[model samples]
Structures are given as structure tokens and as C-alpha cells.
Target chain A: MNKLCQSIRFVAPFLLAICCIACSNDKKLPFYGQREARITKAADGTEKVDTVYQTIPPFRLLNQDSIYITQDAFKNKIYVADFFFTSCSTICPTMHRNLKTIFDAYKNNPDVMFLSHTIDFKYDKPSVLKKYGQKLGVDGPKWQFVYGTKEEIYHIAEHDYLVAVQEDQSAKDGYIHQGWLVLVDKHKRMRGAYDGTKSDQVAQLQKDIAILLKEEN
Target chain B: MRKIVLFLVMSTVIVTLIYSCQDAEQLEYQTYYSNGQTLYQTYCQNCHGEKGEGLGLLTPPLTDSLFLKNNRTVLACIIKNGATTPVTVHGKTYEEKMPAFPKLADIDIAQIIVYVTNSFGNKMGMYPYADINKDLKSCATR
Candidate 1:
């Protein structure tokens, strides 16, 4: 009995360590959105309710290369999206820097992509976005700096991505945009929203992106 | 006697370990400097980096910069009034505009200066609130 107790004590810690490793490796992430119930008639004439996940609406925008991109471009890819302008003086630089860290981490992975939409559509043209991306040492379709109509961009930002952005004439630069870095899955569902200006949250975003990539596999 | 000797040796070892583990900076004038450090982390660390190593050519480095050393008075004004024009730091010109902190107290500016100047290979000593107040007053008038 003494020998058995000694062996059990030796194996218990190993079991606990294995359990911890397994728990830590769990890549399941919660889906964020409004769930709507839909009623459908069964084959036997019984009614059944189905919950549907809100997804990103289809979008059409121009990339930095002046290439027209649509939802089909990111059909089977995970992406990180944020809103910013070329001339933004506050928060945007930090946001870009943090996003750059993520870009560098996953630059080689074709499955991971980035979408940065310019809120100031009038000023940040395709040429301007191309120049800005060049200045930041970022190249396309891996990290696409997109430009589109202000109305469409703002609509997608506020409605689809669940972030706040608007044109505030009174504010600096004649525009206002949220600093939230939104993470979207392959299915165009928003998996997470993190503050782009914060490094810790960005780090969490990187971890979550890894989990999402593994989830697709 | 042996018990007393063992207690003395153990006490000495414990004292040395405790002293070694304690942060020397925290022991010396922590109130102003530490507050400044926290404020720097909140406001400045993002663009300026955690160690004031600045972000590329856009944001200029604050560590051991000839600009910070020469323009100590202007630094106070810049902190309160913001810099709209291009400024040269460490022989490199940075055109990015730094926003003003009109809401930060004069004492807060002083504490931030104290922390920035004392850290990241800078040894410029404590910045008193009086100097900041006088500089801000001059900036306001200008």
C-alpha cells in the first residue's frame, strides 16, 4: 500500500500537468454577434427553430493597387480589419505599429490577411494608400490598404464590424474613427474586437488569430 | 553562543537577500518619478516606445537627444501647446505633429519631465513645477 501510494503521488502531478497543457491548447473561441431564430417546417410537418449567426455583409472596395476587391477576395481567409486615414495624427500611428507587428508575424501565411479601410475617402485615394503602404513597408494582397466611398465604409464599420466611426467636422482632421481592430473568421463572422492602440490587446488578437487558423484546419 | 552565531549568520543572509531584491529606484524619490513613469506609459509609450526609443522616422527618439538637452524650456512649451511645425531631433527632422496636453496639470508636466529626463540614458535631474509653470505662462502669453 505504501509503494502504491508513492507511485500514485508520482503520477498525479504528471496527470495534472498533462491536463493543464490540454486545457491551454484548447482553441475553441466564442462567436460574437446577434443570434436570430428562424422557424422552418420539418419534413413531418413539425416546426423547428434555427439560430443564425450574424455575418459581415458583402463589401466592394478598391485596394492600394487600384484593384477592385470584393467579399470574394477574402472568401476562405481570416482577416484583421481597422479604420484609419493617411493624415490621421492621433491613435492611428500606434494602431498601424501594432498592426505591423501582427503583419510581420503572419506575413508569410497566405491564409492570414489584413484590411485597412481609409475613412477619408476623398483624400486617401488608391494612389495615396499605395504611397502610405509603401512608406510603412507593407505590400498588397497580404495586407491590403483599401479605399472606398465614405458612406459605404462607414456603413460597414458601424453596422457590420460593430465599430463606431463618423465624420465629425468639429474634430481634428475633419473625421473620427474608432481604434478597434476587428478580427473576422473565414466565414466573415466577427470573432473578436480589440483596441488597436493597445499592445496587450493586439497580442491577444495574435493569439486568437492563431486559434482561428487552427480552427479552419 | 552557537545558537546566537547561527541566528546572526541567518539574519545577515536574509538582510542581504532582501536588500538585493528591492528595487533601488523605488527606494529613492518614488512619488514624483514613479507617477511620471506611469503617466509616460499611459500617454507617451505608444509612439515613443517603452524606453523612449521613438517610432521610426515619424516620431523622434527622446533618449539622450541633443534637442531635449538644448530645448528644455521649449520642451515644456511643446508639452503644453503642442508642436505643429517640423522639429529636428538627433539630426533627423520629424514632421509628425505631436498633440498638446492642455488639460494636464503643471505639476503633471513637471513629473513627466522628471521621469523622461532621468530615464533612457538621460541624467538631467528633477524638473520642478515652478519651471514648468513659468514656461507654460510664457507660452500662453506668446
Candidate 2:
């Protein structure tokens, strides 16, 4: 019995070290943005406990195939979202390329989808988006390029997704949008925001998506 | 001993010759095509692919396209001033307007054209700066 205890003591440090490393690498992804609380008074004047997590508000838009997509389209789905325009000559290309990497990684995943909102809706109609998706070799419904009223698009981008977007006549493309790729879980909660143009951040986003998937499973 | 020394000298010369040839090829590509590649990646690769396989029905492929071959001069113009009109490529019509790069200089346009023409299995020869200047002048006037 004494020998067994001594052996355990010697091996315990090594096991603990391995566990520490694993735990550090596999840390859980945090839920991003604010959380709201609602209080209700019962008939006896006792307060009811209720906490409401902030979620993406419902939205309706048209996809590349002229399909009407709404918030229900991503019901119980994990998705990555971004804002871009077809005419952008600078960061949009790099952002798309990086997003393509994630898209390819998660192509076979049924629970995963991509939502790209075009800031330039006037030019990026359903047909144009369809053609654009084809050019990039994107097919199927797993990834969707959506368009809607400029006001709603910008509103969702800034308020819902928590990304910056605006119109600037002085800019080269006559508009400006962020390179942020937001990760939304099945509950429509924003889980992570990555710089769509950076490979490392995108890789982290992919890792977080895997974590989220494991969590769902 | 003398024969061994001579053999070593000859081998060194042969090796140096091979290395020099490879270096020369790399230098030529670096001088002519690298700038155009950077410009293409920045401005064109989003629609036209890295290898010029243009995006689906939106942007036309730059590789072995009869349109690019027939409209070489007009390509420079299109780059300078974005094209809104419909262009037919590979028997399909693409109507997406390619935005213009009014910021690119004549020399920059010339380099990009040379890079594009010589890349993606294209054997078109170099587009001289002088020719680019002349074409851009005419385009500006019209």
C-alpha cells in the first residue's frame, strides 16, 4: 500500500501537467456581447428570476438564387456572417479568400452555413450575386450571399453583428464596410468576431467553430 | 593529381553555368511579371481568379480567351476606365461592370498588361511602355 502511494505521487505531476496543457489548449469559447435581464413580479410581490441573453434579431433578405431567406433560415444553425460588396477592389477580395478557406473547411458540415451580406445591394441583386458566387466556385445552399434594403443591411451590420459599416462617397467604392467575420451559434448568439482578412484570426474562428460543434454534439 | 584538379574546375564551371541560367530566368520574371502579379492580386484576382479563370458568369476568364486575344488594346482601356457594357466570352455573355482603376499610372497599366498577357498559359509578348503610353493617350482623348 505504501509503495502504491509513492508511485502515484511520482506519476501525479506528469498527469497533472498533461491535463493542464490540454485544458489550456481546449479552453471553451466565451459568449460575446451583452446580456440583458428581465424581472417579473409575482402576485405575492416576489420577483421572478429571468436573464435574457442577447441574440441576433430576426431579419429577412434575398439570397444569391433569388430565394427569400429569413432568420428562420438559420434556425438552430451555426453560421459565419460578413458584410461586403462585389465592387470593392481592396480588402473585400482578401476577406473573401480567407472566408473561402473557412467555407471549404466546413463545406461538408450540415449544421454550418455562411451568410455574406452585400453592402452594395443596388448593384448586387440576386442574379449578380449568383454570378459572383459561380465565379468563386461557390455552389449549393450551404453558403448564401444575401442582399436587402441598404438601411436594413447596414442596421444589422452595425447593431446586430456589432461591426462597423457606412457609405462614403470619397471612398474608392463609394462605401465602406468592416472585414469582421462574426460567428453565430445555434441560438443566434454572437460567439466570436474574427478579422476576415487575417489568416491566424480566421484559423482561430475555425477552431472556435469546431468547439461550438462539439458543444452542440 | 593534375587530372583531378582539372575535373573539379570543369564541374564547378558547369554547375555555375546551370545556376546562372536559372538565376537569369528568375530575374527576367521578377523584373517583368512580379509587379503585374501584385497589381492583379490587388485589383483583379477577386473576380478574375489567381490563374485568370474568372469567376463564373460574373467575370470572364483571362486565360486563353478569344475576347482577350481580340481586344488586347481595349483591355488596357477597360482597366483604366471600368467597363459597364456587356462582353461575350466563351460563347456566354457577362454583363457585370468591371470598375475602373483611374489611380493606376500608365506605366503601372503597361506592367499589368504585360504580366497578364504572359501569364496563365498566354504566350503574348511583352507590352512596351511606349505602346501603353500611346494607347492611354488615345483613350483619354476619346
Q: After superposition, how far is residue B133 of candidate 1 from its true place, in Å?
A: 5.9
lDDT of 1 by residue, A149-197 (tens): 9788889888888888888999867888889999999988888999998
DockQ of 2: 0.35
Which portions of model 1 show Cα errors greater than 4 Å? A1-26, A35-52, A86-90, A121-123, A126-128, A169-177, B1-31, B38-43, B88-93, B102-106, B133-142
lDDT of 2 at A179: 94
Question: lDDT for every model?
Answer: 0.85, 0.84
Model 2 Cα lDDT, one tens digit per residue, A71-120? 88888899999999887876777677778888889888889999999999
TM-score of chain A of each: 0.85, 0.84
- Per-model B-chain TM-score: 0.76, 0.75
Best by TM-score: 2
Q: Any runs in candidate 2 off by more than 4 Å, and if so which?
A: A1-27, A36-53, A62-68, A97-108, A121-141, A199-204, B1-30, B49-53, B65-70, B87-93, B123-125, B137-142
Top candidate by DockQ: 2
Sliding window of 10 residues with minimal summed lDDT for model 1 chain B: B21-30
